[model samples]
Target: MLSPEADAPLRAAAMTWLTVRSNDGADPLPRHELESFHFEGERVPLIDRQRGIRKPAILEAALSIITVYRAEGTTRPYEDGTGSDGLIRYKWRGLDPDHAENRALRVAMERRLPLIWFVGVAPGWFQPVFPVYVAGEEPQLNQFALAVDEVFGLVEPETHLEAQLRRYVERVTKQRLHQPVFRSTVLRAYTGRCAVCALAHRDLLDAAHIVPDSHERGEASVRNGLALCKLHHSAFDNRYLGVTPDLTVHIRQDILEEQDGPTLLHGLQRRHGQKLMVLPGPRSQYPSKELLEITYRRFLEPA
Candidate 1:
């Protein structure tokens, strides 16, 4: 187990989350307390193990959160922390996903228990790792890895391994940082209504990016997104429809002109030039005209 000092943040976060849930009269405790600073929930233990502080040669790391460094330049990746599958490998607190401590995860693929990693970025700065699951390993090549919905890899990354590792970790961190908050912000901005057809079903609503998350100018901000329904979101992504910077809806000319069913005509094509069904408040919180133009222009592009 890690020292009390290093494990403080995760313990606090877990306890706070549990307390908040319990206070709301939801699941009481939400977690089973095994001891002080130790808890269990979601069928896994939230162990707080120090990155390199060995606990007398045996430790529990499965289903836990770990901090990389105790301080700046103090990160101790367990010696022999990486095993390459000739082409790729993974580093998890110097232990691979296949380590004995993580045996349950391997045994129960459906559980998809998440490993929440924390990196001591600087002397007191820590960042949470995106929750990732153990994807299988290349035993012959000795590589183990992680993923979100799909497996991770370094597809022609930086030549320097350290630089590549930094970028890789940052990529996951950025993804984690962007998604939930961006989704929540954009959804709340439009009051959970689909901007195209005014669909008010929260479950049917999604926060769609004006510019995709992969675009260079893309941002995970309220101003760079729209609240959309699943069907319209697919249409918007597939170029069947679009919205102007001024928030006017526009159906593709091809779709508008084509003779089709009511679902295609009354549902979409006829809606061109209509005012957007929803817009965010505070004026300053409104979508960015510039980002809207980027997608709007794409809407006008041929093919």
Candidate 2:
């Protein structure tokens, strides 16, 4: 719920998605900062108001990627110091793994649809979000763990509850009607630097889609994005230019031959042959070559 403790992490994730990756000029959605953002507790659920049924499951929940914390003082040796393990343990709603909602979570994972969010709810009414994954669970004890990493930030309920310091079986489930949030992943992957010119201005850079968002191949992940500035973003989109999987920038001959002031010559035309300015430190986070090849074939080919 947009509490004081949550301000930093929420804003961080929001900045990555809303401000940083929000390049949708036509249908720009609301921009959220720490101070001015909507806050809600709970996951994307299947609710039938008429039937008086409320079954909660996360389905591409708008609040992306939060860290789930264990009840404040409950202890586990393998859980390490963070009140969390590399996995999470949750009880099935019916305690039956075969429940339709339960099965849907598995399907979501297999299909990799509706980018899964690592949401946390503490026994003491606390919650936080982190960029993590759901590694699935077992029927026995519903035992599981998060992919385990440093949490991005903390979010807590405005009305605090005394920490529930006991081991309780969490009802672990996941479901998504849409793909996962790719904006934060792409923006954070580059550490906020433009891939082409290496510009680091937070407001100036964007998580530019290597493939158009409409294409079936275009995923909303870092592997499908490059941190690009407004200028390169426009150029890249209009087919004024493109980058090879090897990270070489290529200028269309027409743009190269355009008769204009120094802006044309020094700006768009001169970028040819230069290597991409910055790539993610982890090779896995680098834009996918196969995806890049698709983009190159689509927009990089000469007219």
Candidate 3:
């Protein structure tokens, strides 16, 4: 059922399918139409459009894996070109192209010697098939094969596939999973101003997640974060400080009475209370009001 010789074309088709499917605000092609499409080069027809939506079994399976990976925020699909009415080309970019996983994908596709490891998807919604290789002396069939098969089985069966795939694409392309990058973006967006102190300082700034990273259901994104200085980030994380939806800073009353808390109390309470920081452009991307409400409640309670 599997042929190494067929791997290259299959992989190309699959990548193309995945790219088109993940495009935001775009319509997918009917499977029937996809079957009739022709691929350039290679005398053997890559897809049998005459079969009328009965795509190659392997192609369907490969699509499922691509969908899942896109959902996991590991990669992103982008439009490569546009010309034909209501049609578009697509491509993919992984977070770390130099990583072994991406390299393996390149080799399996037989793209080129020291292959670029990336490709563009043609117009259409049909799923594409590709080959996968497992490195081992004994051919570890269970791990590699089972993983691929599981993805294949999920292609059209999952109810939330579209929504999950969208979120995943944004996550991967934006590098949301990389905390440092996420943090830095938020900080840069705020121009290094502390959300609490309103003091702009390049050296002391940090991007703080309103909901701690551990509590974030998905990758830490700008939507769930804020820009704070080192002192404020630590204070906020420790529940010694909080911020309101209006961006006002709140220092816990109990901590203010401590014998050694004068410096913190004076610096935060007298100087910064009720004063709001100037948020960067696009308030929509700022920490959500709902998230701030939850964070404030936790900050007010006993730690």
Clashing pairs counted in every model = 1, 21, 6
Any idea how many clashes model 3 has? 6
| Candidate 2 Cα RMSD (Å) | 16.1
TM-score of each: 0.51, 0.47, 0.45
RMSD of each: 11.7, 16.1, 15.6
Quote the positional error of residue 230 for candidate 1 in Å: 0.9
Candidate maximizing lDDT: 1
Model 3, residue 187: distance off in Å is 0.9
lDDT of 2 by residue, 31-147 (tens): 122114333542222222221111223332222322333322344222311123213333333556766545544553343322223322221111122333334455575322233
Q: With candidate 3 superimposed using the best TM-score fit, by how many Å does residue 286's alpha carbon deviate from the native?
A: 2.3
- Return whichever of 2 and 3 wins on TM-score: 2
Best of the candidates, TM-score: 1
lDDT of each: 0.55, 0.48, 0.45
lDDT of 1: 0.55
User: For residues 156-265, could you state the per-residue lDDT of candidate 3 as single tens digits?
Assistant: 21134465653443333333123434554566557668766667866677778888655653335666777887877888889888887766777788666565666666
Q: Report the lDDT of model 2 for residue 222.
A: 61
**What is the lDDT for 160 in model 1?**
41
